[model samples]
Target: MIIEISAGAGSPSEQIRDRVTGLITTGALARGERLPSVRQLAADLQVAPGTVAKAYRSLEADGLVVSRPGSGTRVSDQASSVSPALARAARRLASTGREDGRDLEDVIRVLRAVW
Candidate 1:
């Protein structure tokens, strides 16, 4: 569960948001998988608690994650079905990266360039 914040990425909260979205999209964080508490993520990511809270709140608003009263946050069951295009794109990016020795980031850039 290591999330590395890139120096060239966006703001901390947005970066966290993107990373969490990637986790759900790639199935790394499965439906109903428990996420770290906001305090815990803040400590681990060295970001403010508010930053983590903002990211979690955004995910909740988008229905990608759910907060349980005492059970912590869990990846939403809906995330698995959120976007057909995203799922397909994720799979394609993974396959392209594996077969051609391209990175997923590179694949994304190429896809964007072509389309």
Candidate 2:
């Protein structure tokens, strides 16, 4: 929920989207957790409200979050449940790779190649 927007990054909306997605996928934002209001987040990030709205819309479309009138936005309970599980699996994989003596860069390279 602590998003730092870099001026040198891509479009503001894209940066917002990427950060939110990363948080969800890494299990930092739990399912059903409410996100800051679009206006509030935009003000905090110094971007237009529309930018945050666009990012929220994108996350909604991707099944990563949900927004309801009066309730604001929250992580999607169903889809988000899968993200933490996937993150846990990834962490286990990384741990096993390290135990097997694989360097971080090599593990990253393998992951990228496979991906």
Candidate 3:
């Protein structure tokens, strides 16, 4: 998977995490699709391997991705089970926030307050 991190986005790790999440939610990344290795992705994104690893760890914790010895990481089948409507809404909200020059944390705070 080719992942791009916006220069003005949040931290590298958070940007990676959000990008992967968006890909999964939008069905661009299919269930069980293997993702690039942490080292590979870090090199591609020009970030530290630890940053990519951290993002992968967070995704795994959220049940969006899975990793196994020698198998690398793959999108979890259950990841696609997230409600499409909800995902779309989230993407829209994030886009709106970015357009409004709000950071992700600020958007998250608003979501938390509304939720």
Best by TM-score: 3
| Top model number, lDDT | 3
Error of 1 at 71 (Å): 1.8
Q: 1 or 2: which has the higher lDDT?
A: 2
lDDT: worst 10-residue window of model 1: 81-90
The alpha-carbon deviation from the true structure for residue 63 of candidate 1, after best TM-score superposition, in angstroms, is 1.1
Estimate every model's Cα lDDT from 0 to 1.
Answer: 0.86, 0.89, 0.90
lDDT of 1 by residue, 1-115 (tens): 6687777678888889988988887677889999999999999999899999999999999999999789999999888744667777767777977799886678878878988
> What's each prediction's TM-score?
0.71, 0.72, 0.75
Report each candidate's C-alpha RMSD, comma-separated, in the order given. 4.8, 5.4, 2.7
RMSD, candidate 3, Å = 2.7
lDDT, residue 93, model 3: 96
